[model samples]
Target: MQNVVIIGAGQGGLQAAMSLRQEGFEGAITLIGAEKGLPYQRPPLSKAYLKTGDADALSLRPASFFEKKQITLVDGTHVEAIDRAARRVMAGDRSFDYDHLILATGTRNLRPPIPGAEQALDLRTLDDALRLRNALDRPMRCAVIGGGFIGLEFAAVARALGHEVTLAEAAPRLMARAVSPETSERFLALHRDMGSDIHLGDPVCAVRADGITLKSGTEIQADLVLMAAGVVPNSELAASAGLAVDNGVVVDTRMLTEDPAISALGDCAVFPDPVTGRAVRLESVQAATDHARLIAKRLVKQVDDPYGAVPWFWSDQADCKLQIAGLAAEGDDTILRPDGAVFRFAGDRLSAVETVNDAKTHMQTRKRLAQGPVARAALEAAEFDMAQV
Candidate 1:
């Protein structure tokens, strides 16, 4: 292929462009994004950026890097439609044809349906972070809707900055969907100790101008409201173009769509898990960057190997850092180690390992998972030593 057109300019999209060049693909690459300015990391928007307000540090690549790589960056532009028959994408009056089309559209924050939800601020982009930082300059009461990573991260930072933080989650525990019950409880204690009022099993029914109303008929007064419930994949463009989309753009093990000429990656693509053969969509820098690298190899070097990188994730809250190795499904059995490492198991096999401020165990678990599924018996024989497993 002599030309490649990728939609979305988030971390995954930028990585695809860079990976293609690294793989020696001398094709014409065009990376399109709806956001303005150079692509930056989203993880830090709620962590370091909130504390330092350093936008420059979040940039994935400098302007000179793109110019040197000869990658065309079309920022502040939206792909209105894809012409499948003609193999071109239309954005207003501009049009670009591609020999291979990549859908890296990423995702957007899901705004829960509630009265006055529009009044709540968002932290999905750099612009959103800047607005939030400006609001935090003076004394303000902060109410965060959702106890997921984004919400909890922001609450930790807001509380650290001397703001009264009230975090509300519909689920019974913080990060309920991602972490084990034991891990969630650990964070609950940590956040509560930090003076953050934790409200679980009570979701915000409505976001008012002054604060939020909970499902349990409780009203919390605050000067600022943050919406970080979750994210929805940006798959509408792929679906409209007649490509199969389920949860995210459905792709094979090779990360290619039904149409071999097209491929999808990152948070927007759902592919078969190399281990379990289940369709899974992941939202992590590791998954996105790995997907890009694998796709680049396929396009440039004709590599046919399936994408099988073990998924890992991390979250920074206050002074504690939570790191997870491998993917775990809901209802996985959990075992808590004396040293505070939590291991998740699906039947007799190890699914994921959760650690707090234990980088040594986290890295070892990641390497182990990459080899293959770890049997529960093996872990038991090792006495829960991640290195032995």
Candidate 2:
């Protein structure tokens, strides 16, 4: 049995440890994290946790599970550096050797340069969420920067809480990087219908204590400002240790880095897309957990399967639930289904399907993608639903 040392005790790192044990690998597993307390899910920090404030519900597994599984969890300790020559990791003054190392450090919210930007809050980690939650206790006009998933999610929640919410995006549409133009337009209407002042293609130039001023010189008065612009991959540790870092820690199809002794997963690692071979870093809980399981299987049971799992994502904005089954690159053609579902096609191949408030369709599309490809003619036939297709 090999000794596995996992960095970043987030969803991915924790899953890697549990998956290793589940695969019946009787080996030493150490999960190191910089965050204090237990590892928690960050997605709900902006969605459910904003309204509920349940820290217990966010945890992936309790401390007892880690102990019972013999998974050594080291919390509140930052991994200072990596000694590649000795295959050891430095956390403060302590060091731990490993037969294999998995880096699942995840990503941190990108705080762009704006005047008095520190006054703006973030919605990434648990601490950020808690601070924002506490700030929401009093009635306040809030301006949210960025139109990404987390930003939009926060905007939706804030608007529901009777806060004067203004959502500003540098891009013309919401979730520009991930979702299609059609989906972006749909969400824009939804948020606007809910009385949110949504600004597109405009970035905030300054974040004053009282309000935010956009680049166009339009001032949006608000009591709170949330900076949800985007996230930068936490790959500095891996990159510093001589691993390739392009946007994220570059890994092969097997999720192994150039060193072979080290592997990276979750939002921090850039791996080749199973279908397109294009390098991409995903920030979904599904991707993180699945990537961890893939690495675990490879390390333990010697299941050398390529990372072929289909990519899927979900975002809850207000009452609408946006679900995407696959990664439809920018150039993909989107076909609007009869039920308002959007099916994306890259040339003749099915690229992705975007559905709002349609969990069944989402699950079916994901299953179909896993079942392999369907003919373009079959999809266009209308006789074949996503399931039969």
Candidate 3:
């Protein structure tokens, strides 16, 4: 490959460019993004940025790094279309040709269709976080829509800032999609203890200038409303380009699309689970960076290795840090350890481990999961002690 063009200059896109250089590829690299400014980390936007307002600390690399790495950084440009025959992408009137293209389009916040929903704000981007921070400068009653990680994180921060927070979730429990009922209950309690009014099993049906109205006709009076319901993958561009798209841009285990010249990764790409072989799309920094490295190695070293990294995630809420090791399905069974760690099992095989403020156990569980599947029977025999197992 003589020229590599990476779209969406987020974590995955930036990593692809850097990995390509690290793998000794001297090709011309162009990293394009729709947002303006240097590529920054998104995970901190909800946690630390809301408090410190340190946009600089969130930057993955300095501006000088891009120049020294010989990577062309194109910000504030949205790729319009892809010409498969010409192997080039069009951005406005400009065009970029690529021997290889990496699509790291990422995702956009899902704004549910509700009456006056436009009045609600989002926390997906840096600009969005800045706006929310400014809104929090004064004492304001905040109502958060959604019980997912972003919503809970923001609620915790808002509560810490002495703002009255009211969170509404459609699900029966918080983080129902991502965590087990046991873990969800723990976080729900944590948030409640932090002085946030949380309402479960009730979703915000409407957003007015004053506040939000839940599905139960409960009107929350708040000056600021945050829409953290969820996010949809930004896959329209790939679908328009005739690339296969499922929940996200469909890619093989190798992270390559139907066309060998194009590869997709990060939140926008759905690939097979390395362990379960089921199609999965992850939204964590680990998956994005790992996928980028695999793609880069495949391009530079001509390796055809399948992506097999263990999936892990973390969310900081109030004083609690919840860490999950491995991926677990919705139907997976859970075994709660005596010390509060939750072990999820798919049939007899271990699927995931959840820990709060326990980095040692979290790292150990990740290493164990990476080695191979652990049997529930083994854990049972070992008395649910991971070390013994």
**lDDT per model vs. reference:** 0.94, 0.90, 0.95
Clashes of each: 0, 0, 0
Model 3 lDDT, residue 269, Cα: 95
Pairs in clash, predicted candidate 1: none
**Candidate 3 off by > 4 Å:** none
Q: For candidate 1, write residues 1-389 as lDDT tens digits.
A: 89999998999999999999999998799999999888999999999999999998998999899899999999999999999889999999999999999999999999888999999999899999999999999988999999999999999999999999999999988898899999999999999999999899998999998999999999999999999999999999999999999999999999999988899999999999988999999999999999999999999999999999999999999989999999999899999999999999999999999999999999999998888889999999999998897
Rank ordering of all candidates by lDDT, starting from the highest = 3, 1, 2
lDDT of 3 by residue, 177-209 (tens): 899999999998999999999999997889988
Off by over 4 Å in 2: none
In TM-score terms, candidate 2 sits at 0.98
Q: Count clashing pairs, candidate 2.
A: 0
The true-versus-predicted C-alpha distance at residue 137 of model 2, in Å, is 0.8
